[model samples]
Target: MDKVFNAITTSGEEGVFQTELCKSFSLDSRDGSRLVGNLEKQSLITREKALYNGRWTYKLVVKKSIPVDAIEQKPIDLSSVEGAPCICCPSQHLCSIEDESNPISPAKCQIIEEWVTISFNKFMMIQQTEII
Candidate 1:
């Protein structure tokens, strides 16, 4: 399954025809169909109907790549967001997504928008510095 997925991934966005893929691996039609079907069922790949050399067949396209390493889980640091404008917002008590008449909603808050813009710029700068 991993080998099949690797082959499809290497094929890029154009993808590989199901018949050709099966042939490359010397897989019988029934087994090959089941293999690709399993991958499709797992959401690892998508099969699209296509006409290749005047013959109808399905093209196997990679949907998502499986990570080689397990991601490290770390506790989120809330201190990083201590300076958020909403933290000390005077109208934070009145803010509500459901209230259409609420004038202090986060969606329509200029202060929050400005804070986000500044924070995003700072974050980008930090990323660029790390890259350097």
Candidate 2:
């Protein structure tokens, strides 16, 4: 399968014919067709009918390549935002202007002010330490 896909990709945008693949890999018509069908089913390639020496034949074209890096992507670490105020706020979901009950709006929210003040104080302390 890899060999067949590699061969098709090597042909680039021009693509390669089913008969060409059969000849190149020494595969029979049934096996070649089955391989192409599988590649099409997986969305790795596309097959289209075209004129080949006065006969209709299929072309094996690569749709897209599976990125090796994408398969091994590093998981995101949200450690920095672990204790953030908005995320920890108990009334966050109920905080809205339209809601009449327990309407903890953002403009006059005490929770946000306290959190911001504490964070600012910590930042100032860090700055003072650096200056000293």
Please write out the lDDT profile of model 2 over residues 42-70, one tens digit for every residue.
99889999988787789878997678977
lDDT of 1 by residue, 1-132 (tens): 899989999998889999999999999989999999999999988999999889998999988655657666687988567578887889988988898787779899999888888888898999999999
Candidate 1: which stretches are off by over 4 Å? 64-132
Ten contiguous residues minimizing lDDT sum, candidate 1: 64-73
Q: After superposition, how far is residue 105 of candidate 1 from its true place, in Å?
A: 46
- Looking at model 2, the pairs that clash are none
Which residue pairs collide, candidate 1?
A: none
Total backbone collisions, model 1: 0
Which residues of candidate 2, in runs, are more than 4 Å off?
65-132
